[model samples]
Target: MKKYRKVSREFSKHTINALRYLVKKKIISQMLGVIAVGKESRIFLALSPNGEKLALKIYQIENPSFKQHVRYILGDYRFRKLGSTWWKIVTLWCSKEYRNMVRAYRAGIPIPKPIIFKENILVMEFIGENYTPAPLLKEKLPQNLEKAYDNIIKIIYNLYHKAELIHGDLSEYNILNFNEKLYVIDWSSAVNIYAPNARELLFRDIKNISIFFSKNGVKIKPVESVFREIVGESISQ
Candidate 1:
């Protein structure tokens, strides 16, 4: 574990400062170490003032690599006017993720509990036991493909019907395989059902999952049926 360092709270500040701001905001008190430095966000193991362990995800403002986020953010109706600036897009992306996660949580979907979020810092409940992040589904394929496919399908169902949302970008990468269960993560691209392109995104999400499961030998019906069943709307062939 790396020692926790003090830094600035704003995105203009170094990443450490951004983390410090999260601590001061009571989003997290301190961090044990960095977990994963991903493309969009860096994950860290932190401590609450009350001593509970938390996960801090700091979105890089300066030098924020939004190379892959372009498609999803541009697709959302809520993120219009995010001009060509990279930081502006990153800020909006984090806000979207926090809002979507909160909505999903209220609807009883299995999402990480969001603690607090600033312009770019997001503190959330850590899914792992000590410090390690839960492995992604791509890393840890479920031993039984059938059960894994079922779990993912159920999650998609709840996300649409209960949360009234669609994960605009989802795949094995955004799904965590932990404690013999499937936990959805990386909600930075999730969009509400009222979004203009919500159904298209949902169909894409289901199709990706179906493709993965099929490759693993789990039989799945067409993505169409899955989408209709989840949203409770019949569609023409």
Candidate 2:
């Protein structure tokens, strides 16, 4: 129970009810433990009644950085008319992440399959074996550097062209290296390609990936060239 205090403290009445609802609906049999914690959400390792593993991400309504989420939500046409309350904002944020993951999954990108979401809680496929969470790219370096870089690039290209979305924040920290396969996580910051700052965000994402691979001894092309290949245009300096 002590290990769960850190996560339970962040759950509000609404989130508590939402979790209960998940249990009632049999979406999850029981929560196993906290897998990870971020500034805005806590990831819990959970189990299904049928013996399947799942990841539960519950967003904190009182997150200090709640204001930052508005930028991502405002540009998302689906939630354009979102209310201006704290609860409304955070719930919308959770929805945004679920929607983005669905888009990426349908695009054939390597990502956790989104199962369901309600209010501030989201359930998805767990990415690991035997209840152990997979390590981030920053923690576990890929064995095939060249192939890894190429695969990541392909994901980026498909994300933009096929899904019409851009991962606003892409870095080694947000990508998971599971069994030599790359899975991009943390889609809360992703935005539609038509979002106001989409181009800028896309450029930043490309630069981040390019820099990471370069440091890992993979000689990649200039960021600008890769960006051009992705977006099919040159941005004026």
Best by lDDT: 2
Error of 2 at 171 (Å): 0.6
Q: Which stretches of candidate 2 lie over 4 Å from their true place?
A: 1-10
Where does candidate 2 have its weakest 10-residue lDDT segment? 1-10
Predicted candidate 2 versus true structure: per-residue lDDT over 181-227, tens digit per residue: 99999999999998988888898998999999999899898888988
Q: In candidate 1, which residue pairs clash?
A: 7-17, 8-17
Residues forming the 10-long window of minimal summed lDDT in candidate 1: 1-10
Q: Give the alpha-carbon lDDT of every model.
A: 0.77, 0.88
Residue 204 of model 2, lDDT score: 92
RMSD of 2: 2.4
> What's the true lDDT of residue 151 in model 2?
91
- State TM-scores per candidate: 0.85, 0.94
